[model samples]
Target: MTLDPQRLLRDLFDTAIAAAHPRQVLADQLPADRSGRAIVIGAGKAAAAMAQAIEEAWEGELSGLVVTRYGHGADCTRIEVVEAAHPVPDDAGERVARRVLELVSNLEESDRVIFLLSGGGSSLLALPAEGISLSDKQAINKALLRSGAHIGEMNCVRKHLSAIKGGRLAKACWPATVYTYAISDVPGDQATVIASGPTVADPTTSAQALEILARYGIEIPENVRAWLNDPRSETVKPGDPCLSRSHFQLIARPQQSLDAAAHRVRAAGLTPLILGDLEGEAREVAKVHAGIARQIALHGQPIEPPCVILSGGETTVTVRGNGRGGRNAEFLLGLTEALNGLPGVYALAGDTDGIDGSEDNAGALMTPDSLERAAACGVSAAERLADNDGYGFFAALDDLIVTGPTRTNVNDFRAILVLERHTDDH
Candidate 1:
């Protein structure tokens, strides 16, 4: 192929982003104008963009508010967009979350409540339980981040500790027809796991939340501890009457984004082999992918050379040290080490939201000489991997990709390109 590799990669990334752009995917799924007012309330990296989409699409009277991470907000006409701290709760988040919950209250059956949920909403829509201050929630959220807990576990604790999450938001909508349009950021796209299922019934128990806290060695305040220990704090479970009229739809997902990227790769005169949506420890996933890519390059078993292997899903990082890296970076670092100068293999892994685990860099790139570059600089890839300093390694090499707030999130997108070795000419 005569295509410039960098340009081809950029095009594939853009295609993935376009497929998950809230304005494009969510607008088509909104409920048609009925004889009622449409009130939108949501939180996530894409909340503001989703709100903007609703404003542009809905013909009837539309008014609502949404919360998104700082720098992730888009301009909207009617829907008020609030910027909040992410992966941790802050006062800005608390205020906006309260507003969203209160906005849905007092809605009648004639009114329709539209919830635009997406990744990062758990923190964007923070509303600490009674007697639990935002500071407390913030502390716990930070602890969870470093605890190596999966998204599902983190959100379980989030649901029980918040006043607005779980099914409380749906309960606030009362007799209103509550419709939730979510962009899946969690594995399996479970409704209750996305944004802690603010408008959906939570099947998790408060006891389970407590267990997570204990597992992470997180100490809640006396009052907060008591609340979680009590059954009263448990989120509304399945069969709750409050959620009878609640409706949910998954508008965008990691798989769709991956497929979009794969399509673009194939269009660029390359084959596309998609790895199924995967999750777990970032380094382990990277090792597995490296093996597969090596196989493709040598044996061409699973896939032929001159192809790109694409995958998407969220990955977790077990923070063993105070490293300035996210899971995606960690994965790239591990992959680089595993490849060990394997020729003609290039890879890119990035979180679709433009941020990876609270870091500025979206992710890192790996080239065939990645290990050589590290060795030349006296950097031990093994040492960095052990310290969870993936970002530091890439930053030293200037190989980090920083895209600054894509305004949408569909979890992580990974691509490993294997090129065939050229034959020597006579």
Candidate 2:
């Protein structure tokens, strides 16, 4: 009960990250080595870590490549761990992705392909469809990101425009069994939506992808539009013979991480109310969380004080301004604004991958005096939030939580700590 709120919340966040680390979860989910060679191809924040785990556990010929966000790489002797751009595709990603296709292509039935997938895979595996340039994909990625499209919607568009995603990777390894190990960062953990389901059958269609783009008002070149209209652009669907040998399993998930954090909360003598892996617009979600925290603190209708409200999942942000912040930072800022300096309340929001929205920091923290502290520095929480500059806002107050790449991703982790009720107005 006497634990420092900051330390306690940070401890909880650490617990969640550890629970989802590839080293902790990938080893168990790895399928028994297939009869032949083991070729690992993966992309995401955890791809390199997953490869490292495979090298430690497997007793066979291991070879292949994986692409991760720059600085998220792990050392692997056999499997090459390549780093690339994320939230935006770059030449490095494109180069590595082509290499991955070559590695998996022409594989025999006796060979096994272990495809590691996690958050950021969509951008890390940046193979644009035929006639679609990398810059084109880059532009679309930026637009979708700024348009506030949910992961699924953005991925739907990505799937149709990618040569490697949406089951194409599995198809490239046709005749060879594909074993996909994934760390879930997407809401609902749908394999088809995670990293655009590189190795799993995509139920989403090209038209759906086009519709998503249109719904978001994303403009595309005529060539890209024509590709979507073509039948060949459609992703491999369920029951496709190419994916007959494909198998998938979730190695780690946001909910499991949240559950781990919740366990830590209980051990601290605080109640843990976990809001399931939820997703939506970042600020909007923060507003809802603030409401729950206020209710518990003021009315105690749902839970008493000295409790932590935990939630996890990916949230989107519609970029209306040129601001420097990720969704988690934005969420923290939004929560701070909504709380209106409610006493005895503290919160931390971060991404398990250690980076949020192109920012170096994992996220930021918000204490009861968060707004006041910002005000003292001539920083207006309302103004910063309006500018979508959560990183800048928190940076000024020195509240940004900077955890260099954790090398694993389970999406966003948020905690609202309500220690006591300060408002007496009923």
Top-TM-score candidate index: 2
What does candidate 1's lDDT look like per residue over 250-369, in tens digits? 999888988888888877778999886788889999999988987877778687788998988888887897677999999999999888888888888888899988889888788888
Q: Write the per-residue lDDT of candidate 2 for residues 3-116, one digit (tens) a residue.
A: 799998899989999999988997777666434568888999989898999898888788889999999998899998889999799999999999999988888998888888
- Segments in model 2 whose C-alpha atoms lie over 4 Å from true places: 33-36, 423-426
lDDT of 2: 0.90
TM-score of 2: 0.98
Local error of candidate 1 at residue 17 (angstroms): 1.3
Full-model lDDT for every candidate: 0.86, 0.90
